[model samples]
Target: MARSIKNPKKAKRKNKESKKKGEASSSSSSVPSMPAKVWQPGVDKLEEDEELQCDPSAYNSLHAFHIGWPCLSFDIVRDQLGLIRTEFPHTVYCVAGTQAENASWNYIGMYKLSKISGKRRELVPNKSNGNESEADSDGSSSDEDEDAQDDAQPPVLQLRKVSHQGCVNRIRSMPQSPHICASWADTGHVQVWDFSSHLNALAEMDAEVNTGATNSFSMDPIIKFGGHKDEGFAIDWSPLVPGRLLSGDCKNSIHLWEPLSSGTWKVDATPFLGHKLSVEDLQWSPTEADVFASCSADGTIAIWDTRLQRTPAASIEAHKADVNVISWNRLASCMIASGSDDGTFSIHDLRLLKGDSRVAHFEYHKQPITSVEWSPHETSTLAVSSADNQLTIWDLSLERDEEEEAEFRARLKEQANAPEDLPPQLLFVHQGQKDLKELHWHAQIPGMLLSTAADGFNVLMPSNIENTLPSENP
Candidate 1:
């Protein structure tokens, strides 16, 4: 059962007071108030008179904003935050492509989302159960400071848009050079652009006083290739090799992009043709430059090496339906996550492919999954968005604890009525968005995730999920 946010401030305060009272009273003296019941999204239905209620305790920080035109795809532009940011009052840079009413109205946008203020809520022990066990708690007094920041000034969304020829199907920024981005357009052309000038413009505007305005400009792509017989959605830049690229088309052909010293890319004429159907998504290996992975509409995933062009090194029958998306785990090279058209997502262990490659599978989303991404900082963490209008975060390291659940049920009998089917690995489920298309975790910010949909975009960070990113402590 998906719930919406009502008055987060009020809910936060109320939950805080209740927690204090519960903490004061002994477990035997008085029974603590039960929490809001949890329910599955597609399985549970709200009645006509039943309205959705927001649980403020569920989130640490949440904000929503829109661009004039909805974006079909976007990629976060890396900044100088040193890649493991844990602080707040955060700022983000990204590039997005619009799906406008007319082909000519479409644009590739560069954005600077600033003043996203909030701290990571601290988790306290749950004293209600009399057992010394840790559980998620409501926000502390520091929330008041965050609320003040919100009231004084809301988060800002600033952008500079460049006119494009057609609707963009997908867009990806080079990890090595974020200002350089590759976009696949519906016009059956793949184009690369240098947004250095636009990034500089946004940076300059940041030094000025506040003004609500969007800057627009016209620019041509640095490189344009129309070699694909049909449009495609799959495109990715090699992480290990700067400027190296792979683009796959609906005609089951994938082309390689090799950067030249002259600031242009040389496209190989002989395309890789291992997949028998449309290539839906592509991901380059995080560890090996020549190694990559691709998923297809034929329900198969192929592992390929650029050195051996024509055939895949290994192939697996990954899903029963079209594999729409795949995310290669950078922190754990052996693990890859894939989402399918049949509303299921699975984790594959490449080393175990000869036996049973799939280590984990989920059927949580009832609609087709549009996006799947592994958390850059956490090896066992992942975020997924689906056509069902929901974004979910999962922690693969978690598993069902029957003893803990029994203790929880004994303490809060009514509220602990979560269905037995609820996957323990699922950490959070975010709703209220319409037709959620894609979600990406900020590599700089530990727990924050940005999602795009038909209505607009949402930036959210859940309070309960712990930061399990490997320590950088000296």
Candidate 2:
């Protein structure tokens, strides 16, 4: 019997239904569409009238933070209660930037959560009191001084300066220290900053103080690694090793760096090259520190074992257009997910090699997949964002019948033994946005994900849910 052709219409309908069921189960039975708000210039607050333009059922909960255009950088800090630090969780920090000016770019003001209002507001320090300005010879405050001191007390919670004047694309916390690795586009430099000291320096830098006179303020980067003639697009520090770092550039090269005994860092090896076009994204394996993955504009994902010299240990010709992102499964090191400009996402298993040494592949999306991220906490859950302005989450652990699992295993085994073509499982698709550019999963939250687009809106969504909102034009 001849094999049946995969019907695109039938597949799409099934996916739509599956998404609806998933959303209905997770959220309250009712689903309502959220209306879009008009954009007004210089609006510093999210008003009640301007609720999220997407569906409430689409996201788990809304956490609003005002930001600038081209929001190129973000970080997630987990609280002791195991919740991702959104505004309601005491404090949150958000950094955003724009590339409007050449050579000189503006680092917008940093904002923090207000203790009184319970919303994000621009950070400003309280004024000092005149009576408390001078201390008595006995080192005790007078009655008048005591009264002023209370007024001059610092804000219960404040958003202080973290860094300034640099185009930071990504920030990765150090495994050992309280330091973080920050990659910059303008300087082509990667540096480590002590968070405590960095924040203090940022406050002084933004303070209204005289620059010509000597002041008790100094800000210095602890360690700086130099390379990359072009802009650095993506950077990653080894999850296992503290100081070892890997960065990819617009020049289509990956450079490795390590700290040296002389108190400085040096390039440990020659640049590794495999992709024909610019390298867009790179990530180190969660399980193995020496192993890493890189995706490029050449439309390929290459897995590299740093110990290998000439070429990648394994390669997947997965996408038809530029491969924008690739993420490794935290639970299964052998499994990988990738997104491409051709409007498709693919899941690959490195163990399933064909006769020609190609890896196994499964297709997921019909629009340019701009971003893909695997959940850090869950092994089988993955998230993807696309140019079609949709963010979809996949639950690979969903209960599957024995026959289905066996068929999938048989297909994988056949690819390992002999090359054969196969399609991937159709996961849920959250379609609502327009021109999506980035996708990120909250590090601490298992099901929460963030998706941003060129339309100046960054959305948060719950995994395994459907967005019931109507689509808007880009």
- Note each model's CA RMSD in angstroms: 6.2, 17.8
Whole-structure CA lDDT of model 1: 0.79
Best by TM-score: 1
Which lDDT tens digits does candidate 1 get at residues 81-172?
57666666788888989899999888888878888876554333234445433332222343464455446456777778898888999999
Model 1 regions more than 4 Å off = 1-39, 122-152, 207-215, 409-417, 468-474
Model 2's alpha-carbon lDDT is: 0.52
Global fold similarity of model 1 (TM-score): 0.87
Question: In model 2, where do residues sit more than 4 Å from their true spots?
Answer: 1-53, 78-103, 108-169, 175-178, 198-220, 224-226, 260-264, 354-367, 398-435, 454-474
- In model 1, pairs of residues that clash are 1-39, 1-40
TM-score of each: 0.87, 0.61
lDDT of 1 at 167: 93
Which whole-number lDDT from 0 to 100 does residue 92 have in model 2?
30
- The superposed Cα distance between candidate 1 and the true structure at residue 284, in angstroms, equals 0.4
